[model samples]
Target: MKLVPLGDRVVLKQVEAEETTASGIVLPGQAQEKPQQAEVIAVGPGGIVNGKEVKMEVEVGNTVIYSKYAGTEVKMDGTDYIIVKQEDILAVIK
Candidate 1:
């Protein structure tokens, strides 16, 4: 199964959060923060949305940073993914 985003939406898979701190301290599940970084899996076709012509700047396989609370989570084939509006994506990693 695959996800195909529509209308300025993007599909992504979250990057794994660190289980240990830089100081070598191990963090438990509850102590780990939700990862804001994700890999673009699918991108929507850019078109007129909200009366504005939007062009998609990100492409598939690009790593991106998004708002911490952005997007809706989906589970498929035991894998997790998130669907967010393009605006919610803060930056694309080079």
Candidate 2:
């Protein structure tokens, strides 16, 4: 099975949190923070949404930064994914 977003929705895969800090201190799983970075897996086609023209600026495989608490989490086929709105995406990494 695959995930396909609709309207202005975007699907992303969260980047893994770092196990160790810059100071070289290893952190436990419970101490790790939620990652704000993600990679685009699937994108919805641009279309009218809420009476506004929604154009998709991001594409598949695009690495992006998003709001901390932006998307809904889901597990599909043992793979994790996040479903968010295009607006929730802050910027695409070059």
lDDT of each: 0.82, 0.82
Q: Which regions of candidate 1 deviate over 4 angstroms?
A: 18-35
Candidate 1 weakest lDDT stretch, 10 residues: 24-33
* lDDT of predicted model 1: 0.82
User: What TM-score quantifies how close candidate 1 is to the native fold?
Assistant: 0.79
What is the C-alpha lDDT profile of model 2 across 1-94, one tens digit per residue? 9999989999999777565657432323333343377889999996998899999999999988776465799999999999999988888878
TM-score per model over all chains:
0.79, 0.79
Model 1 agreement with the true structure over 1-94: per-residue lDDT tens digits? 8988889999999877665657432323323333377899999998998889999999999988876466899999999999998998988877
Model 2 lDDT at residue 60: 94
